[model samples]
Target: QQQVRQSSQSLTVWEGETAILNCSYENSAFDYFPWYQQFPGEGPALLIAIRSVSDKKEDGRFTIFFNKREKNLSLHIKDSQPGDSATYFCAASPNYNVLYFGSGTKLTVEP
Candidate 1:
């Protein structure tokens, strides 16, 4: 099982700069942490989320830096323009049911 790891499949920004994508997970009872943002065909919705006592989570330009004891988590896309590109998923859940996805991260916000 790959537990969950979205090191990176794609990422490139320039319009304004700011496109980081790094996530890690290994169960540990996961704690409902979600972060999705798609724009190709449209599906992934939730933009920011953090549970496990919360470490950080924003919503405007997007931001989420959680590290529940090093479970690992990251997703920051500020200024980055160009419609913020697309493709970004780093999810996990062990409370609100099952939900584990980290096979995506193709953001190219170059203008």
Candidate 2:
């Protein structure tokens, strides 16, 4: 069964705008979240991440907003560029053990 869920199947954003990808989880045991970005023909790479202890995590133009009580999170891509277009997967783990991934959200950035 799927434990993680993404709200959007696809998203579009213009250059310099912020792209938001939302996610939620069913397992409260999950403590670690890693958002992965994948380009065509390439493996997903760690974009940004957050622990249940942190309500937010920011890395340059990328930021993760997490709400442990709500069991939800969102990834914000600030100043989005065309090169930022890709598929993003939200994954959760219980004590860094097995990971549960959400169906990816494909992001399209228009310049």
lDDT of each: 0.86, 0.95
Distance (Å) between predicted and true CA of 35, model 1? 12
Q: List TM-scores for all candidates, in order.
A: 0.32, 0.97
Task: Name the candidate that leads on TM-score.
Answer: 2
Model 1 superposed RMSD (Cα): 10.8
Q: Which stretches of candidate 2 lie over 4 Å from their true place?
A: none
The number of the candidate with the highest lDDT is: 2
Number of backbone collisions per candidate: 0, 0
Which ranges in model 1 have alpha carbons more than 4 Å from their true place? 17-28, 31-51, 55-62, 65-74, 81-111
Pairs of residues at least 3 apart in sequence or in different chains that clash in candidate 2: none
Q: Write the per-residue lDDT of candidate 1 for residues 21-104, one digit (tens) a residue.
A: 999999889998888888987788987888878888888888888888889989888789998799988989888778989898
lDDT of 2: 0.95
